[model samples]
Target: MKMNKNYCFIYSLFFFVVSMFFFLFGISIGFKSMIYILEWELINLNSSSVCFSMLLDFKSMIFMSFVLFISCMIIFYSNLYMNLDYNKNRFIILVVLFVFSMMFLIISPNLMSILLGWDGLGLTSYCLVIYYQNSKSYSAGMLTILMNRVGDVCMLMSIAWMLNFGSWNYLFFYYNENLSLELNMIVFLVLLSAMTKSAQIPFSSWLPAAMAAPTPVSALVHSSTLVTAGVYLLIRFSNLIFMAEMNNYLLMIGCLTMFMAGIGANFEFDLKKIIALSTLSQLGFMMSTIGLGFPDLAFFHLLTHALFKALLFMCAGVFIHNLNNLQDIRGMGCLVNQMPFISICFNFSNLALCGMPFLAGFYSKDLILELSLMMYMNKFIFILFFMSVGLTVMYTFRLIYYTMSMDFNYNSYFILNDEELQFIIPMFFMVLMSIFGGSFLGWMMIDIPELIIMSSWSKYFVLMIMLIGGWIGFELSNLNLLMNSLYLTNKKLVFFIGNMWFMPYLSTYMMNYYFLIVGNKIFKSADSGWLEEMGSQGMKKIFDVMFKKNQNFQDVEFFIYLVSFFMWIMILFFLIIFKM
Candidate 1:
C-alpha cells in the first residue's frame, strides 16, 4: 500500500514537471511549425517492420500543451476528489499513463508508433472508465473497450494494407491521387478508426455511459484528451481523407449525431449525461467540418472546445461532489446564488459551448457555420447543420435555466458550498482561459478562412438559429408554451427524441442481440444448460442485461425518421435557404 501510494504520487509529480517543460517548449515554438521525425533501419529486423518516427508540427505542439496543462490540473483536482479512496495511487498512475499515451499519439506520425499510443489510450481509458469496480462500471468498461476494439481492428487492417504500399509510415500517402483499390480501402479503415475512437454515431453509447467513472476522470478523459484523439488523427490524415463519397457519408453521420445529441441533451435529466451528450454533439460538429473540407477549422474548434468543455466538467464535478453524487438536474436549481464562483464557471463554459461570440467555442463554431453555408451541397445537409447548432443552444440554455436560473430544488437536508481549494484552483485557470482560448488559438492557428457568404439569408443564419433556439429553450423549459397532451399524444416521438434518437439502442443492442442469442444457445448446449462453465456465466449475465436494456427501445426509431426525412428534406432545404 505504501509503495503504491508513493509510486503514484512521485510519478504524477514527475509527469507534472515534465508536462510543464513540454508546455513551455510548445509555447516557445509559438505557432512556428516544426517537423521532427526519427527513423531507424535495423538489418536484423524485417524490412517492412523497421521503426518509423514522430511529426511535431504547430498543431501538435499547441494541442500537447493544452492537453498536458489540463491533465496537470485534473491530477491536482483528483488529489482532493479521490482523497477518501484507498486506491488513489492506482488511479493517479492510470491518469499519468493516459496523459503519456495521448502525448505519444500527438507526437507520432508513423502508423506503427502511433498504434503504441492509440492502443494505450484504448486500454488505459478502459481501465479508467471501470475504475469504480462495480457492476455499472464493469458494463460501461466492456462497452468502452469493445467499441475501441473495432477501431484497433480497423487500424490493424490499415497497417496491413499500407504494407503493400512499401512503408509503415502513412504520412506520405495523404495526397496520392493515383491509388490502387487497396489504398482507397486504407482511407476507409482510417475513417473507421477515427469514428470509433471519437465515439461518433453508432459507436457513441459508451461515452454517456462512461460517466460511471469518477468526475475528475470524466473531466480529463471524456472532455479533453481521449475523445479528441480521433479528431487529431483525422486532422493529421485529412489531406487524403476527404473523398467525395466518404465526405458525404461523414456529413450525414456527423450532422445526424449532432442533431440527435442536441435533442438528447435537451431531454437529459442527469447533469453529467447532459454534458456527455454535449461532448458528443461537439465531436459530430468537428467531424462534419472535416467533411466540409475545413480540417483546419475542425482542429481550431477542437482546441477551443477542449478549453471550455474541460472547465464545464470540472464545474459539474464541484456540484456533483458537493451534492453528494446527486446528478439529476431536476434535483438541482438556482445554483448561482449558492456557489457563485462555480456558477460563473458553469455559465462561461456553457455560453462558450453555444459559441456565444468571443469565447473559446465562438471563434470556431461561427466559422464552421459560415463555411457550411458556403458549401454547395444538398441544402438539407446545411439545414441539418444549422438545426444542430440551434439544438446546441437549446440544450445549453435548458441546462443553464434548470441549474442556474430557478430556485434551488435540491433536498433541504443536502448541503452545497464552495469549499474545496483544489477544485477552486483548477477551475479558476480553466475559466479564465475559456473566456479567451478560442480567440488566442484562432489567431495562432490560422487566419480565419475568408467565408464565402451566399446571400442575406446566409449572413443572418447564425444569429437567427441562436436566438430562436435560446428563445425556445426558456419557453419550453419554463413557460410551457404547449400542453402535456401534445407530448402524451406523441409520447413515442418524444421518447425517441429524448433518447438521443435511440442511438444507444442502435449501437449496443442491434449489433449484438443476434450474436447474444446464438451465444446463449451455445452456452446451453456446452454446459448442459448450467450456464456456469466456459465463462458462460459472464455471457449469460451480459445477455440478460442487454435484453433488459433493449426491451423498451421502440417508441420511435431512426429508421422511421430517416424514411420520412427523405420525403421532406428537399422541400425543407429550399425553404430554409430561400428564407421561406
Candidate 2:
C-alpha cells in the first residue's frame, strides 16, 4: 500500500511537469508557425521505406499536453478512489500506459506508428474496462473491445491501401493537390475507422457500456481522452476528407449521431450512461464542425469539452462513491444539502456542458453552431442540428432536476459529503478550466476572425431553442402519473430512442443471433449430418468393401492350388501332343 501510494505521487508529479513543458512548447510552436519532424528508418525495401516518425507541431504538442495533464490529475484522484482495492498499483500502471498510448497516437504521422498507439489504446482500455473482475465488467469489456476491433480492421485496410503509394507515411499526402482516385478510397477507409473509434451511430453502444470501468477511468478515458481519439484522427485528415468529397456524408453521420445521443440521454436513467451519451453528442458536434470545413473549431471544442467532461466525471465519481456505488439518478436528490462544494462544482460543469454564456463550452459550441448556420445546407441537416442542440439542454436540465431538486430517495443512513481533497483538488483544477479554457483556447486557435452573417431571427435561434428545451425538460421532470402513462404509452418508441435506436442490440444480439442461427443450421445439415455421411464416413465404407475383396484374392491356399492346377494342365497337353 505504501509503495503504491509512492508510485502514484511519483507518476503524478512526473506527468504534471512534462505536461506543463509540452504546453509551453506547443504555445511557442504555434506562435512561430513551426513544425518539427523526427524520423528513423526501420526497414528499407525496393522503392518503399518504413520509418518511425513523430510530427511535433502545435496541435500534437497541445493535445499531448492536455492528455498528460488530465492523466496526472486522474492518477492523483485515483489514489483515493482506488485506495481500498487490492490491485491499485496495477490500475495506476494501466492508466499510465493508456496515457503513453494516447501520446504516441497524437504525435505519429505515419499509419504504421499510429497503429501501434491505436492498438495500444484498444488493449489498455479493454484491460481497464474489465478491471473489476466480474460478469458485468467482462461483458462490457468484450463489447467495448469487439466494437473497437471494427475500426482497427478498417485502419489496417487503410494502411495496406497506403502501401500502393509505396509509403505508409500519410504526412506526405496531407497537402497533395493532385490526389489520385486510390487516395479517395484510402480516405474513405480512414473515415470509417474514425467513425467506429468515435462511437458514431451504429458503433455508439460501447461508450455507455464502458461505464463498467471505475469512475476515475471513466473521467480520464471515456469522457475526455479515449473517445476523442477518432475526432483527433479526423481533424488530422480533414483535408483528405474534403479532397475526397466525403464531407457531406461525414456531416450527415455526425448530425445523426448528435441527435441520437441527445435523445438517448434525455431518457437514460443511469448516471454514468447519461454523461456517456453527452460525450457522444459532443463528439458528433466535433465531427460535424470538422465536416463543415472547420477543423480548428472542432479542435477548439475538443479541448474545452475535455476539461469540463473530465470534471463532470470526477464530480460524478464523488457522488457514486458517497452513494455506495448507486448510479441511478432516480435515487439521488437534494445532494447539494449534503455536499455543497461538490454540488457547486457539478452544477458549474453541467452548465458549461449546456454552453452557458462565458463558460468553456459556450465559446466553442456557440461559435460552431453560428458558423454552421452560416453554411448553405439543406432543411434536414438544419433541423437535425437544432433538434440536437435542444435535446442536449433538455437532457442536461432533466439530469439536474432529477439529481438535485427532487427529494432524496436513497436510504437515510447514507453519508455523503465534500470532504475528500483527493477528489476535490483535481476537480477544482478542471473547474477553473471549465470556466475559462474555451476563451483562452479560442484566442490561440482562431488566427482570423470568422465573418458570420445572419438575420436577427437566425442569431437568436439557439437561445430560443435552449429556452424551449429547458421548459420541456422541467415539465417532463414534473410529469404526473397520467402524463407518464400518456407519454410512455408507446413503449416501443421509448425503447427505440432510449437505447440509442437499438444500436447495442444490432451490434450484439440482433446481428450475432442471426449469424449464429445460420451457422447452427449449416452445422446440423452438413457437418453433423449429410456431409458427415458423404464425406469421410462414406469414403471409409468404400475403402472397407475394397479391402474385403482384396482379402479374398490374397488367400494363401487359393493362390497355391490355382498355380499347381495350371502347371498340371500344361504338362498333360504337352505329353498328348508328343504321343500323337
Candidate 3:
C-alpha cells in the first residue's frame, strides 16, 4: 500500500511538472516555425531511413501539456479509486503506458513512429478494457481491439504508400496540402483511419460497448484523448483533405453520426452508455466543425469538451461504485437530495454538455452553429447541424430529469454520497475547469470572433433550439404529461432510436457473420469430408486390405522365394568354376 501511494505521488508530480514546462515552452514559441527533433535515425532501409523525429509547435505543445495535466490528476484520483485492488500496480503501469503512447502520438511527425503510438494505444486500451476479468469484459475488449485494428491497418497502408514520397516526415507537406498522386491516397487513407478511431458512423458501436472497461479507463479513452484521436488526425491534416470528395463525405457522415448519437442518448437507460453516446455525438460535432473549415474551432471544442466530459465520467464512476454496480438510470432517483454536492457537479457537467450559456461547450458550439448558418450552404446541412445541437440538450435534460425527480425507485440499503475524499479531490479540479475553460480557451483561440450577424430572431436561434429541446425532454420524462403507452404506440420508431437504429448489430454481424459461415462450410468439406477420404485414413485402410490379400498367398510366396534362392546359388557356383 505504501509502495502504491509513493508511486502514485511521484508519477503525479512528474507529470505535473512536465505539463507546466510544456505550457511555458508553448507560450515562448509565439508564431515560430515548427521545431523538429532531427538528431538521429532509428532505422534504415537502403535509401530511406526511419528516424527519431518530433515536431514541437504551438499546437503539439499545448495539446501535450493538457493531456499530461489530465493524466496527472487522473493518476492521483486512481490512487484512491484503486486502493482496495491487489492489481492496482498493474493498472497504474498500464495507464502510464497509455498516456505515454498518447504523448508519443502528439509529438511524432513521422508516420512510422506515429504508428507505434497508435498501435500501443490499441493494445494497452484492449488490456485495460478487459481488466475486470469477466465475460462481458472479454467480449468488449475484443470488440474494441477489432474496431481499432481497422484504423491500424489503414495507417499501415498509408505508411506503405507514403514511401513513394521519399520521406515519412510529413511536416513539410502538412503546411501545404498534398505531395501528388500517391500522397493524395495517403490523405484519404488517413481520413478513413481517423473515422474508425473517432467512432464516426459504421465504426461507432465499439465506443458504447467499451463501457465494460473500468470507468477510469472510460474517462481517459472516451473523454479526452483516444476517441478524439480521429478528429485530431483530421485537424492535423486539415490542409490536405480540404474540399476533396472524401472530405465532403466525411462532413455528411459526421453530421449523421451526431444526429444518431443524440437520439440514442435520449433512449439509453444505462448511465455510462448514455454518456458514451454523448461522447460519440460530440465527436461527430467536432469532425463536422473541422469539415466546415474550422479545425481551430473543432480543436477548441475538443479541449473544452475534454474538461467537462472527464469530470462527468468521474462522477458517473462515483455513482456506479456507490449504487453497487447498478447502472440502469431507471432505478436511480432523488440524487439531488441524497448527494447534493454530486448533484451540483452533475448538473454543471450536464449543463456544459448541453451548451448552456457561458459554459465550456457554449464557447465552441455557439460559433459552430453561427458558422453553419452563415455559410452559404444548402438547407439540408443547416437542419442537420441544428437538429444535432438540439438533441444534445434533449438527451442531457432527460438524463437530469431521470436522476433528480425526487422519486426513490431503488429500494435498497444503498446510499449515494459525494463526501468521499477520493471523489472530491479529483472532481474539484475538473469542476473548476468546466466552469472557466470555455472563456479561457475562447480568449486564447479566437482572434477575430466573426460571429454571424443576421436578423434579431436569428441571433436567438440557438437559444430557441435549446429551450424547445429542454421542453420536449421535460414532457418525455414526466409521467403525468404523457400516457405510459406512448412507447408502444411508436414501437418501431422507439426501437430504432432506442437501439441506435440497430447500428451495433450491423457493425458486428454484417462484418463477421458471412465470413464465419463460409469458413465453417470450407472446414467441413476439406477437413472432415473429402480430405479425410484422400489422406492417411484412406491410405491406412488400403494397406490393411492388401496385407489381408497377401496372407492368402503366403504359401505360394514361400515356394517362389525358395526357387529364386536356389537359382541364384547355382548361377554363382557356375560363375566361380568358370573363373577358376
Candidate 4:
C-alpha cells in the first residue's frame, strides 16, 4: 500500500475518534454498572481488585466521560480550524497523540503509567505550541517546556520516593505504612508540581505566553488536557494530599494565583490572551476546591470550564480568521450585527464562563465557593474567591462589549463564510451544553432541594459582585484618567512580581561580579599559561608516541596476555571493594 500524506492526516483523525469512542463507551458502561450496583444495594469494591486499584468507579467514570467527550469535540473543532494551515498533517498527528496521551493518563491503573502519559502529553503540547516556528511561538514553547519539566521532575522524584521508601503497589500503600515524614515530603513535592503545571504563581507567565499558538491548540491544551493534568493528579492522589494535611498551603497558592491572574487578565487586550488568563484564574478555583478536600467539586468545575473555555477559544478563532488574524479587541466592533449567530453563541458561553445564574459555570463555581467556605472558614480566601469571580465577569463582558457592543467601520472584506460556519456550529453546541449541562448534572449529583437553594446564596452574591465589577471595568475602560492610572499601577505591580521583589536582580549581580566574571578570566588565563599548555601538549605527544607506530606480529600473544592479566587484577580489586 502506498502511503499518502493527506491520508495520514485522515487516518490520524479516524484513529483519535475511534479511541475517544471506546473511552467514552467504557465510561458509559461503568456508569450503567454503578447504577445497577446502587439499585441492588451491593458493595463490590473487593470483587475486582483491578477496578478498585484503577479507581474506575462512578466518580472516575463521570470525569472520564467529560474528558473524552471534550477531547472528541475539540478534535472535530480542530479539523475545520486547521484547514488553512500548510502542515495540517503534522498538526493532526500531534493532536491525535495529544488526545491519546490524555486518555491514557485518565485510564492508567498505576502511578507509572500516569506519569508516562503525563510526560507524553506535555511533550506533545510543546511540539504543537511551537508548530508555527516563529520567534514568539518558539520562545513560548521553550518556556512552557522548561517550566513543565520542572514540574515533571518534582512528580518523578515523588514517585521514586514512594516506590523506594513508601509504596510500590498500584494503590496507595504508603498511607497505611506509617511513614508520616516521608509521605508529607512526597505530597509537598507533588503539590509543587501541580502548582507549576497548572500555571500557578511564579510559573504562570508561560501560559499567557503560550497564547502565541494556534487558538485550537491553546483551547485544547489549556482547557482540557495539559493544564488540567495537575488537578487530575491531585484528585487521583487525594488520599496522600489529605494524609499530609497540606490543605493550608494548597488553599493559599490557589487563592493567590486566582487573584494575580484575575488582575492580569483585566489588563490584557488580546482577545485570546484574555481567555488564556481567565483559564488560569478558573484553574485556581479548581485547585482551591481540591485544597478543601472537595475533589468532586473540582472535577465538576473542570467539566464546566472545559465546555465554555473551548467555546470561547473557538469563537475567538473565528473572529480572528474572518479578520485576517487580527487579535486585538480594539480592532473589532459591532460584530453582533454582522455575525449574529456567533455573537449570540459567544455571549452565551461568556455568560456561562462568568458564572451567571442557572448556567453551567454557576453550578460548579457555586459548589466550589461553598466548599471553600466550609473547609477554610478564612475570610481572606473567601474574599479572594469573590474578587476573582467579579474580575472574571469584568474581563468576560469586556470581551463581549468590545467585540459586539461598540461601533466599528468593519470592511466587507472580512466576513464569515460557509467554511467558518462549520467552526461556529461546534461552538453553538458548546454554548447549549454550557447552559444546560451543569443543571442536569447538578440534579443528578445533589439530592437536597434546599441545599441547591442554599448554594444559590453564594451564586447570587457572586453574580452581584460580577455585575458590579463589569460596570466598573466598562466605565474605567472608557475613561482616560482611570485607564492610564490603572495601566501605570499594573506596570508597577507586574514589575515587582517579575523581579521577585528585586531579589533576582541582586542575585544576578552577585553571581556575575563575584563568580562569573572573575572566575572566567582567571580560569581562561590559567588554561593559557605555559604549564597548562605544556600539560595538554605533553598529553597529546604521549598519545602520539604510544599509538603512532604499530608492529604486526603473530608473536604478540605474550603482550596481550600481560594486558589481560592487569585488567583482571584491577577488576578483582574494584569488585572486592564494591562488595565490601
Candidate achieving the largest lDDT: 2
| Global lDDT of each candidate | 0.82, 0.90, 0.84, 0.73
> C-alpha displacement of 316 in model 3, angstroms?
1.0
Best-first order by lDDT: 2, 3, 1, 4
Q: Write the per-residue lDDT of candidate 2 for residues 213-290, one digit (tens) a residue.
A: 999999997555778999999999998888889999999999999999998898888999999999999999899899
* Residue 94 miss distance in model 3 (angstroms): 0.9
Clashes of each: 0, 0, 0, 0
Each prediction's TM-score versus the true structure: 0.85, 0.90, 0.88, 0.79
Residue 274, model 4: lDDT of: 86
Q: Mark the 10 consecutive residues where model 3 has the least summed lDDT.
A: 30-39
- The regions of model 2 sitting more than 4 angstroms off are 174-179, 480-483, 519-580
Tens digit per residue, CA lDDT, model 3, 1-580: 9999998889889999999999888767734545646536877887688887787887788888888888887888888878888999999999999999898888888888889888888999999999999999998889889999999999999989877767787765654345467767888889989998898988888999999988888888876678977888888888778734456777788899999999889878899999999999999999888887888888889989988998898888877787878899988878888888778888899999988899988888888887777777657877987898899999888888888874878766766677887678778888898999899878866767674777778879989999999888867887633635767688888888888878777777866777767778888998887788788778888988998889868978999999999999999999999999
Give, for candidate 1, the lowest lDDT window spanning 10 residues: 41-50
Assess candidate 1 and give its lDDT.
Answer: 0.82
